[model samples]
Target: AQSVTQLDSHVSVSEGTPVLLRCNYSSSYSPSLFWYVQHPNKGLQLLLKYTSAATLVKGINGFEAEFKKSETSFHLTKPSAHMSDAAEYFCVVIGFSGTYKYIFGTGTRLKVLA
Candidate 1:
């Protein structure tokens, strides 16, 4: 079975500080991992993805994550946080075989303190 666990349900950060959101995943085979962000009442946007290809993956809005197979983790990070970055983030994993269904973590809510 494939699953993902978000380490934090909520993270609070100042506008200019760095941001970190931790995630752990378990898979029976090579898994596709993704981070998605959703603004208030808005659609989910892809932050980054880790295929079998890249270890260090970068995405939009100055966000990035590193796929660590040994650690079984993919944690999202940003050099600097923005007020607009205040939103909800979900750690997702795609099933290894059969129907390609998504497994979403509970979600981490980012609160940007101005």
Candidate 2:
């Protein structure tokens, strides 16, 4: 079984500062991980994804994440924070063991301060 845990329920960052959101997962095998952001009354958008291909993955809005197998962690980071970045972020994990299953984290809400 695969499960995702978002370490923080809320994160606050000042504009122009760096942003970091932590996520951890557990799976019997290598699993696919992803970060998705959802704005108010909007659909979820893919921030970044980690497959077997690359350990470090980059995505839209200057966001990036590194897959660490040893630590069982895939943490999202941004060089700079923007007001528009304020949203709910979810950590998702997909594991394929005979059957495919998806596990989602509780989510971390990001608030950008001027």
Q: Global lDDT for candidate 2?
A: 0.94
lDDT of 2 by residue, 1-114 (tens): 789999999999999999999999998888899999999999999988888989999999999999999999999999999999999999999977698766789999999999
Q: Model 2: clashing residue pairs?
A: none
lDDT of 1 by residue, 1-114 (tens): 999999999999999999999999999999899999999989999999898998999999999999999999999999999999999999999984567999999999999999
Per-residue error for 106 in candidate 1, Å, reads 0.5
Prediction 1 TM-score vs. true: 0.97
Minimum summed lDDT over a 10-residue window in model 2 is located at: 95-104
Question: For model 1, what is the error of residue 78's alpha carbon versus the real structure, in angstroms, after optimal superposition?
Answer: 0.1
Judge candidate 1 against the unseen true structure and give its global Cα lDDT, from 0 to 1: 0.96
RMSD of each: 0.9, 1.2
How accurate locally, in lDDT, is each candidate?
A: 0.96, 0.94
Off by over 4 Å in 1: none
